[model samples]
Target: MLDFFSSNPIIALAVILAVGLAIGQIRFLGISLGAAAVLFVALGLATANPAIQIPPFVYQLGLAMFVYVIGLSAGPVFFKEFASRGWKLTLFIIALLISLVALAWVIIKALGLDSMIGAGMFAGSLSSTPGMAAIVQIVNGQDPSMVGEPVIGYSLAYPGAVLGTILVAAIGAQILKVDHLKDASEEGLITAPLVWKGVQLSPEITGKVGDLPRLSGQSIIATRIVDDPHSHRLADPQLPITPGMQLLINGTEEAVDKAIAALGEERETKIEDTELIYTRLTVSNPEVAGRTVGDLKTVEHGFMIARIRQGDTEVVPDRNTVINLSDRIRVVVAPGRVAEVRKFLGDSEKSLADVNLLPFAIGLSLGLLLGAIPIPLPGGTTMSLGFGGGPIVVGLILGALKRTGPITWQLPFHANRTISTLGLALFLAGVGTSAGAGFRGALTDPSSLIYMGTGFGITLISALVCAVFCMAVLKLKWDESMGVAAGVTTNPAIISYLNGQTGTDLPNRGYATVYPTAMVGKIIAAQLLFLLL
Candidate 1:
């Protein structure tokens, strides 16, 4: 079995992924290792056999896909959060990185560990494959003979680092005695996503739907209005709300509840035979592109924009929410007015699926170009973004930029996720197999345990300290703090755990907000750690 796998890297990878993913699903105490399990599975296989190594290109491709997708997903929030609290978040991430590197430095120096080994440990402890890659890139340019040192240290430290992070997150949350669900609710994390609710208009309720208060920044769309006779019509915001009427309201739960308090009781009425038709129209009309949601004269056009489906997430667009090309928007309209609404939104599902691959190709090409460009350090050394940093940086920029004329730099939600998942899986398999031989040898060296322990300590301390600081000093909520901690480390498993606990995407938002900066910073820091040592 070992000999067969050792000779066939492709088969080895498939087996590794299959076993790893299956293992990842085995939840213990409500915690699953997720894709991080792949790395360990690969490591185990490689460790058992010295020759089970895949090509470097597979790993590079995987790393690029994972990082790029991450950046793209986080881009919108990344830019938004950066504009508000980017510096603070950035400083926090930088401080955490510095602390981890500093602690690792002290331990490595005390143990008389080699500089390359220390670099590997640093990258591994952070669970940053990009960081490891960056270190390797720097080392290759300076001293090719020392290339294996970082990988060895990284592989040895990797398992402990990932586990330590998970432990720190769980333990820290326990220590804080955090009621994640309640805390998330109070922090308005769960309410971030727009949801639909059916609201009835009472006798006391007066005025048109448009006249209702905006209700704490939540956008309210009355999709269908059921009159006293149970006849339903598309809700024109300007249309007066009669007494004993029912409304299919679209907004956040909090917003809907608030509206209910002011208007009428909550009703779960399904309106299928109504004159009001609900349909999702894909935006292909060039005139609608770049227009804000509020700018679209929906009421005048005999329809209401109920929800805007942008990629995987559905957004309840406020006045400021910009409409882009290929955005599948859910609009409420009369059957006769369907043609008018369709014309306005371009109503083509085919267009939504018709992805122009040029932007991705161009963006990646640019990213690779940027990564290859060398920058000189003070000591006459040089560094570059390499494959990992380049594509990610480009993806982030394009994602944040959202669009440039007809060329939108974005992938469909599912496509991005699939690509990213495949990329990370391939990367992890390659890294694990490559490091397997070294990891086994390191275990026999005695010093490997010390390196692992030190890396583990760094991971724990970094996560714990960062979490505490974010909560205590920055005044961030528990969910946000955990998210930041996980984000700074660039570990999706931690984010997933936190999100599970919180029952919200708050952790994900926090992770996305800091990920771009953290990724770039860590890449630079990894090289610096090696160079300085």
Candidate 2:
């Protein structure tokens, strides 16, 4: 059994992932990905496997796959957010990254630790394995053996970071108590009660349109027609009758009867007012599929398109764009005309469960391949091509160019979740196996462990301080506050947990906003600290 465990690293990884999944599903002590790595190390140590090894190339492959998946998920919404919200969130994320680097730098200088070790300390403190790997690649080239210590150092502090983030998130939610449903009820934000009001036609307006005294000069009470407090008036008394016009003689029913006697016209049956109508429709027809806003106008009643919500992202339709099946459309139109629009567009009901997973897998695989191609950076440095910050950049470019896949292929929630989980598991497994072997060697010198500990201490202090600032000063919600800490860690799992607590589908956005800056800062800090020390 021991020999089997020793011989099969892939099987070992699969067991770890399965354990993680089970723990996640059962809510057993909130075991994080970082904690899983720590557990793997403990297991390896207990077994006394001195020759424990994981191929360096596996690390590269895992990193590429991980980054590629992340990039594909973040690409579409990141730019859309930038265009809408402007620079506030972007600036905040950038500031946090700078703060983390500066804090790491100061701690390194004070401790007199090796610069590379400092970098490792920074990465571990953030719980960011990819950042550490990136720095190692930059400083020590693609040789994994040369940069092994820093990666090990990073692995040491990751578990604590994950736990710390979870604790913070739960506490924040308890404190904030953000209940949108309660607030909406208290504020009377909806008009369902007003929708039940009945309409009556004035007796002055008979069945015959011409017999009705010219309403052209009168200020007609059209409140139910448009929901506007102000009423509209006919410009000409000679104007002919429309299908659904209401005429009134006086404010009361008796006055209306006297007016009908004077006008010699009979009252027609009352129709439901247009302003009380609300239409809900789903897109089922193939005509709108893969078309953008520009293409939608050609369909009759398509002009009634008010808003288009695709997954978590919602946007106003434009003329050049195409619509996809299952996209929800909200429009304001006359009560009688709504059926016409509905009939023209077809059924719009879409089940969230029907989202296609194929495109996501294809995009993710392609992204991974693209990320694995190593590219040279400035100076004498060349980083491995696999995912991390570079793949996200490449994916964004590809997404914009429509080179990677179809532009209309919107990412589904389940596919994103699956890819992210698998990628992270592989990534953490690589980090754990690599670190488990090297940790023993690195700890041989007590001074090295002391230096690493000090660096981790600095990271913890910096992260906590920033977290406090985000909460106390910036007044960010618990999820957002935890997101800041997770940003420092550069681990998607931490972000995912926080988003889960918030019950939102925007874990990808939180990751994307903080990832690039964290990656760069961590890499620079790790390398500069190693070089300087």
Candidate 3:
């Protein structure tokens, strides 16, 4: 068995991934490693046969692919946040990370541990795969033998980091008697409920659809209008409105109520008929992607898009609503025009699932090139972004841009997620196999336990700092602070647990708010920790 695995790396990898993922799926006290389990599985497999090795390119490609996708997903929100409250949050995270590094330094000194191992422990305890990659690159720049040394420390500390943060959040919340859900409900911070409503136009009202009164700073889209009792049409700005007509709108319930009060009497109206109908379409066509709803030429196509659902958030779309790949848009079209609209939007599920290789390849190539470029440093020494940093940096920029001329740098949401998972899994498995021999040796060392304990301490400290700073200083809610800690740790398991406890996406909001910055920050911190050691 060992010899077979040693000979064929592909078969070995498949076995490791399959087994690891299965192991991860087993819930232990309501927690699972999810994709991170692949690492341990690969490590165990490799220990049985030290010759079982995957090529360097596989891991390198995996690292680049993983971080690049993360960058793309984070770019839009990261920039938007920076423009608002990101500065304070960014500073807080940086300080917290630096403090953790200092703490790790102290522990490393006390234990008399190797600097390389200490660096790996720091990365592992913080749950940063990118950090581990960065450390390996700089440390093993000349010597490949040292590559496995750090991974041993990473392995010891990885579990501690994951479990420690979760424990702290749960225990800390209970100790404080903080009712996260109740607090949110009381604060009116809960997400608004969406609804479709109708308003019967007052006899005194008469104007174009855009002239309708609406809630200030709230979403209220005029989707359809009933002019004659027998016929209904899309609510276009050019479409004239007369007395005794019903305007059908979709938006948050509160926003709709206010608009209905302003427009006329609230009424229930059936808008769909033979002449006009609406259908939901997945935006999979490259030609239409990155274009706004108005650019679709709805009038020319005898259609009007009223709503769009992107991931978990849904919005009443406008002319300038830039359509992204995999967005589900509600389009009201002429009865006979559904086929044409479907073709134009590329509504096929197959198209939505399959990635456009042209743009993906080009974007990845650009990221690789960026990573290779030498970055100048002080004292004539130069640095590079390497595999971990380069692709992510490029991804962030392209993600924010969304499109350039004709090329959509961003992939569909599903495609991005799929590629990200594949990349991360491959990288973890490869790293595990590469470092397996050293890890096996380290298992018997007394200091391995010390590293594990130290990692747990670091995670608890970091989690505490994040929670305290977010709640006490930033004045955020308990759930949000815990969510922020989860993001800082860069572990999805922690956030998933929080969601289960809270039964709301409020925690997810906090997680996403800082995830991008925290991810990039932790990567830099890991490298800095290595250099400092």
Winning candidate number (lDDT): 3
Of 1 and 3, the candidate ranking higher by TM-score: 3
Tens-place lDDT digits, model 2, residues 401-520: 332223434433454456556666666555555555566666566776665566556556655665677668655544455666676667655776765565453333445555555554
lDDT of each: 0.77, 0.52, 0.81
**C-alpha TM-scores of all predictions:** 0.84, 0.62, 0.93
> Cα miss at 47, model 1 (Å)?
3.2
The global Cα lDDT (0 to 1) of model 1 is: 0.77
Error of 3 at 367 (Å): 1.8
| Candidate 1 worst ten-residue window by lDDT | 210-219
Clash count in backbone of candidate 3:
0
lDDT tens digits, residues 1-533, model 3?
A: 98999999999989988998898888888888888999999999888788888877888899899989888888887777777777778788888888887888888888888888889999999898888887888767858888877788889899998889888878987898978778777755566767887788777777677566432335677777776645777778667777687877877788888878777788877764546787899888888888887677776776777778988777777677788899998887877889998888888789877677787777788888987787775556555677888788888888888889988887898888889988998999988998888888888887788889988889988888888889888888888888888889878778878888777766776787788777777777887777777
**TM-score ranking, best first:** 3, 1, 2
lDDT string, candidate 1, 190-248, tens digits: 55567777777778777777655453234576777766335777766667767787878
lDDT score for residue 77 of model 3? 74
